[model samples]
Target: MATFRKHGKSIRVEVSKKSNLQLATFDIITQVREWTALAETAIIESKSTDIVSNKTVSDTFERYTEEISPNKKGAR
Candidate 1:
């Protein structure tokens, strides 16, 4: 969600998703709204990419733990 507030002569914009938060101050309300929309879109896109990338890492680690790690000298 995005929150807007007045800060002195400028407008403060805040966008948050999960544990990530972004903040910006702009002199015009339209600028703040535009920034907020962009910020939210970027955050959502990053989250989708992370899920796809993490699956690759998870599969590699699982294979190592099950098949390769047990054969190592110090695995005991």
Candidate 2:
């Protein structure tokens, strides 16, 4: 799981994994950075409003799970 918060002008993102896989940890961090960049772009494009305010952590998690779940099952 991951948690993200904003403090002043910067955003802080933390990622945690239940498994002991080192590769999974690296992958999660990479994914988070990618998502953060996409979100930043969205904010820049939508200059009228704040991007973080329009986004929900739950929504992001759901989308991520949906994308990865199929691959996980196939691997098993």
Tell me the lDDT of candidate 2: 0.52
lDDT of 2 by residue, 1-76 (tens): 4466655545566433332111112235466577655555544455424225676999999987888776885654
Each candidate structure's TM-score, on Cα atoms with residue i matched to residue i, is 0.59, 0.28
Q: Among these predicted structures, which one has the highest TM-score?
A: 1
Q: Taking the tens digit of each residue's C-alpha lDDT, what string does model 1 give over 1-76?
A: 9999998999988898855788899999888888888999988777423334346877989989999999999998
Against the unseen true structure, what C-alpha lDDT does each candidate score? 0.83, 0.52
Clashing pairs in 1: none
Q: lDDT of candidate 1?
A: 0.83
For candidate 1, the per-residue lDDT at 41 reads 90
